[model samples]
Target: MSGDDGESTIQRIQDIVAVFVLSITAVLTAWCGFEASKWGGEMSIAFSQASSARIQSTAAEGEAQSARQLDLSVYTLWIGAKADEDDRLADYVEARFTPWFTPAYEAWVADGMVENSPFAREEYVPPGTEEAVELSETADEKFAAALENNQRGDDYSLLTVMFALVLFLTAMSQRDVKTWVGRALLGMAVVLDIVGIAILLTFPIKI
Candidate 1:
């Protein structure tokens, strides 16, 4: 072929490759944006759940504290009545013990005071203690999930940026420039596209 024909063929090939790269990069960029948005939503949901669990845990803990105080006060009153030799008042206080407190008090008495006081016994589980622990654990898991979702969103955002760079390079490659420079830019764009796609494939898809 003549020199002009040969240069024309090269130009045509470069245009084709540049157009293909631009199309693919545009799609990848759009997909990355979509995934990032989805991950962001997941992060929001997880964070909201974590917050709710934490609040519930706090409320349950409050209930437990209130129960503990009430039980302590009643037990103290009973002790005072006993010290004053008022069996009737002591019986009244014992009868008024909360159901949960009664179990611990019974266990304490059954064990022959091996554990000091009812409050000191392992059997003295306050109301809502188990619920508070479970809710706190759930909150921790949800918070961790939120962090992971945030990280996933960031990864997609990073990939979107990378695709944008590929688009820029592909567009630049289509510009009028020295033959080698255009080819170099195109080659770089293609390589970056491959890397971005590989990374994209490794990531978990939301939709």
Candidate 2:
């Protein structure tokens, strides 16, 4: 071929390569944006759940504290009645305490307290205390999830920003630099874009 024709062929090849690189970069940018948005939404939901769980835990804790005070009052009244030999007062104390007793302790009492009473040894928990502890644990789990989702969202956003950089470099390669250096920059941008896309695919979308 003539020199002019050869140069034309090379120019056409470069144009084709540049177009391909730009197209792929555009797709990668869009994908990264979607992933970042998804992660951000998940983070928000997790934060809301964590806040609600924390509120529930706090309320349960308050109820548990109040119940503990009542338990203490009942125990003190029972002791006072027994010490004073007031049968009627002791009966009233027993009746008030019955609702707080666990089913096993109640059964033991029904069996005439022949064996060591679990209630007497204070082995059982109050009704709401266990639930309060569970709520607190749920709150902790939700908070942890929110933190993790927030970090992942940040990572995705950073990747999206990197993809934007890759697009800028690739576009610059066509106009600012037209030699081998420009082709090398385009190649590097293509590689970076591919790697970013792969990472974006690995992350799961929540909701």
Candidate 3:
């Protein structure tokens, strides 16, 4: 081929590659931005759930504490009545024991009373104790999910930046420059695009 024809062929090929890069990079950048926004919404929802669960946990814990105090007061009264050898008063106090405290008190008495108090017994699970524990665990899970969502959002944002750079490089490759400079920019853009896509493939996708 003649020199002019060879140059024309190279220019055509470069234009084709640049067009391809621009098209694909633009799409990828939009996709990354969309994913980042979705993940940010997920993070916000997880954080809200965590906060709600934490509030429920605190409320349950307060209820449990209140129940424990009530049991303690009744038991203390029973102890005083028994020490005074007032069987009638002791019996009345024993009858007044809340349902939750009854099983633990019975178990302690059966075990010959405790250096480990009735409250220490496994049977001593007060009202709301289980709820408090479960709610606290839920709060922790939601908090962890929120953090993971935030990280994923950040990852997508970084990918968006990378794609923006790819677009920049691809556009610059078409500028009036030396042949080697154009090829170098195009090659770098292509490499970065491939790398960004590979990384995106490894990430978990959200709608």
TM per candidate comes to: 0.92, 0.83, 0.98
Error of 1 at 187 (Å): 0.3
Writing each residue's lDDT as its tens digit, candidate 2 over 78-128 gives 769989999899888777773655454566667786765434445456666
- Local error of candidate 3 at residue 72 (angstroms): 0.8
Candidate 3 — what's its lDDT? 0.94
lDDT of candidate 1 over 1-207, digit per residue (tens): 999999999999989999999998999999999999999999999999999999999999999999999999999999999999999999999999999889889999998978767999777888889999999999999999999999999999999999999999988887888889999999999999999999999999998
* Candidate 2 residue runs with Cα over 4 Å from true position: 2-4, 102-123, 176-178
Cand. 1 TM to true fold: 0.92
C-alpha positional error of residue 135 in candidate 3 after TM-score superposition, expressed in Å: 0.7
Model 3 misplacement above 4 A:
none
lDDT of 3 by residue, 1-207 (tens): 999999999989989999999999999999999999999999999999999999999999999999999999999999999899999999999999999999999999999995467998999998889999999999999999999999999999999999999999999999999988998999999999999999999988998
